[model samples]
Target: MDDAIQTEPVRQKKQKTAAGGSKAGTAERRGTDVTRVSEVSLSSKRAATAPIAVLLAAAVLLAGCWDSREVNELAVVMAAAIDQADEQNIELSVQVYNPRTAGGGGQVGQMSGGSGGGAGAFVVRSAVGSTMADAMSKLQEKLPRQIFWGHGEVFVIGEAVASKGLREHMDFLLRSPEIRDKADVFIVKGKAKPLLTLPVPLEGNTAQTMGKLADIHLGVQVSIINLTRMLAGSARGAILPLVQLSQSEEKAGDSGKIPFMTGAGVLKNDKLIGYIDVATMRGAMWVRDEIELATVTVTPTRTERGDVTVRLVRSRTKLVPRIEDGKWAITVESEAQGDILQNTTNVDFGNPLLAGRLEQDFNDQIERRMTGAIEKLQKMNADVLGFSQAFHRRYPKEWNKVKDRWDEQFPHVQATAVVKVKIERHGLSSSGAVRPNDEVQAE
Candidate 1:
């Protein structure tokens, strides 16, 4: 305001001088105008300097404040295993990556049994406490650096820990900010520590190897976030991939042990109720629309011994729930398409009639598997497929009345499974190449 107010009079005097005074006086007034304008410019520049300096200082002070732990300062947790120590305490084992040589694509090496034993990678440490968090703190007490879970790929629950309740011990994972959402959840057949300590030939770390298995769609992939979501959803139950330590083909040494994903563990209300075979687990996976790449072998008839394997290319399943006459029922309809990878039967599937029969047989096989899976789950009083969710979505009002008694009602709930399989393509040959040409049946 002062600069403008003072400059206005200068402009008026300059105009007056231009009209009456000599050229010398006009030039002097113009010089005074330039000086005033320069003063205003300098004043504004000086005023902006303070705020700019303050902002710089603030940024500098806040440089390393938010989640600024260096890699060297952290023990990058590759995996975690939980087991029951005693009646009151729990054992927590973590595979902390040795940051000294963890970087680069090379496999990390560690001494599992002893220094002179087989070469193993990663350090497996254990701690026992009353709770998961307590056990974690105990484990951290022996570490030189803070444990970072951002790199953790999987968490394996021992048979004992799973038999107990997982809901009570899941608080740390649910509440921690550093825990990754995609960390896979697994249930080991025996102790989880042995599985983690095993040296896998293909992948150095067994937990990381399990992550790749899930990614490749070899087994059901249930992440930490997904597990909680499924349990909280209408399902009220969950399933986790089951891992076990298998003997290596070479020898039975400390380094010759490998971890293999065998089956799935069933959980009802956060407690492991039972286990399912891999074959049966596939059926459940189909009902849950979780099977991505699987080969289903079904015989065309009971009398035939030849196997007809179909590679599941794609599949979709829909569970529709309804209430009729106060009776709850769910109908599962699934459609799948596959290519015949191996057909050893005498019948040529290229023919329409044989193809139709094959389709019907495949459909029956799928439905049978689904029926068996549903029966097993129903027997266990577990709704792992979220059938209750369907009912809740379809009949929200009626669902509220029976949700409390879902376990009792689920066992008696009427369910029908319908599956349709289409043989999209037969391999390169129209007939089974293995069969002799003289014994071939055209149609």
Candidate 2:
């Protein structure tokens, strides 16, 4: 009877253990199935939402047209002129483009009607106010379209205005987002309007023609960027290419009745001090290392007769400042490579020996001309050559000590010039085709 009871309990315990194992396995399987279904549902939801997100992005982009600007609605200004009207007011003149005339066909006759009764291709609008912003606003009221400055070519400041002080006037140009700092800056000898009114020749506009003339005819091309750099440099003085209304009959009968570059205007701390002619301006170019295309006529020595015009193909200048015995001296070294463009007399230009002599003679002449210019500038007490800046660069400590007295030290400063010229070619005409003093026969 005891054995039967013990066997019965063991059988009951085995059955309970089997039932618990099956229940635990079922529960684990159900948990894994639930996790897989949740992952599938999340993926389906993301797939459903993607298209709506893309559509919303497209809607935002289509709604915001904040930066849209039409070209026709903007009245493009090709050039601007600023002048002083009075002690309390400033005058602003803008050369606005006439698209009607500009967009006309290439044939000159087709654009004739849009020339505004022979007033030329552009319209000049002037306004006077207390500040540049105010002056520009006043001018805007007269225009039917908004003023656009992206295509501006030149900025002119009248002598009167420049004399007063350009530091304040220039701030508007420098800070404005529309006006380009690359536009050429000029100091007009008189009123700036006369320059804008002058007839344009090949370029169809006065500013374009003048800008080209500044690049080709004259060497002094002072852009707004150049002016800013000059102002920032230790050399506070700046020189701007000067343009004036040429009333000469000779000029009027010439190409397109366009006015010419007169000279260079000297500026002392942003104020017009005086004017220097083309010759002196060339000297300034040598000191400033700005010579691009220069033709030097050198009178030959006893070894060669007649004149040889050396056309400078490439030129460079270096200013070396040194202090000795508590005195400052600047050495101006100019190295130039050129070719004989015109040779009046037969001098063996092909021969290296003869070329050397010609080169020396050319160098001497350049040195003399450059030296004379430096002397003139020194006498005027002008630091247009940036000698003071050189001093500052070489001896910063010493320059600071003498910064206030640079004007006093400049007049007495000694300048030495060294010029080296190399003649590379003699052009297509290797020898003089026509004999000296021989008249050419008409073909």
Candidate 3:
């Protein structure tokens, strides 16, 4: 019985050991399977996450639609015209661009296409309201696309609008971010819209043609920035190139019928006071130091008989203001270089002595003409010459005393002008086929 009991205990120990080994093996195998399953799940998760990451990145890129504007969605303004519709209403006219004509040529694959229509590149739209902004907004409602002023090249203000005071109306132009300050500004004699309606010749648009003409032949091409500067200055007066429709029927032939710059409109405190002809504008140019190209015809009292047209190559003017004995005097000194363009009378062309005599005659003529203009401005009491500013710079104390009464005192002020001109370069072949009467006698 004792032997049987010991054998039973040994058997029980064996059974316990076998069960423990089986349980350990099963747990180890289960752990391996769990790890394999986790690995497979992780790989699947990574595959799914890759596409989500790409999609999220694309979403971030696609989110920025804040300021996006398609080319066709904008109504590009090429020029603007401002006029006074009535006592309390302001008229705004815009020349809007057509994108069909503005787009690049050709089809999807090719790079070429038919040229756009030239005349319809610009479309006119106008509105009337109490203020400039109001007028613009009213016009905007009629436009199918958003108005864009970035490309605007011209701004024309009518005489009625300018004469009434443009400072208030022009505030929008100064304040707008899209409106370029470099755009050229002109003052039209009649309604501003009429100037824009004129047919353009070689150029695509009337605004561009006017801009080119203003730079080349007009009095002075005053940009929006220039106009602002002049208006903001202490002088509080300015001048703008005036454009008038040409009356010549022949001008309507090859070159499309269009208006040309005829004179300058004088503005006092942002209001059009009057117009100055081309001759007077030359004098104003001297005061402003802006003479680019000019021709002077002077009849020299000589051993000769006709007049000579001297074409000026370069010209400059200096202003000197003096205050003494409770009175003001301004001295204008101008110097110029010219060439004899037309010789109506035969004179010694090669002689240096004759050239000196011609130079003296040209100088006298310029002085007389410039002096007359200075006298006229002095009588008009226009400080367009900036004499008041010069006085302020040189004699500050005197300026402080008389600055208030400058307008009243300017008309009576005395002005002296001295002009000196030099004739450089007689054209090639000094003595042409035409001989002088004296030279003929000698022959």
Tell me the whole-model lDDT of each prediction, alpha carbons only. 0.82, 0.79, 0.76
Better of 1 and 2 by lDDT: 1
lDDT tens readout by residue for model 1, 189-231: 7688777776676777787788887888777889999888877
lDDT of 3 by residue, 76-145 (tens): 8888899888999988988776655445442111111111123345667888899988998999887889
Q: Can you list the residue pairs that collide in candidate 2?
A: none
Q: Which lDDT tens digits does candidate 2 get at residues 141-211?
A: 87888988989999988888988888877788889999898899988877786566555546766688778
Lowest-sum lDDT 10-residue window in model 1:
111-120
Relative to the true structure, candidate 2 reaches a TM of: 0.81
Runs off by more than 4 Å, candidate 1: 1-67, 101-109, 114-120, 302-305, 434-438
TM-score of 1: 0.83
Top candidate when judged by lDDT against the true structure: 1
TM per prediction: 0.83, 0.81, 0.77
- The model with the greater TM-score, 1 or 3, is 1
Error of 1 at 341 (Å): 1.0
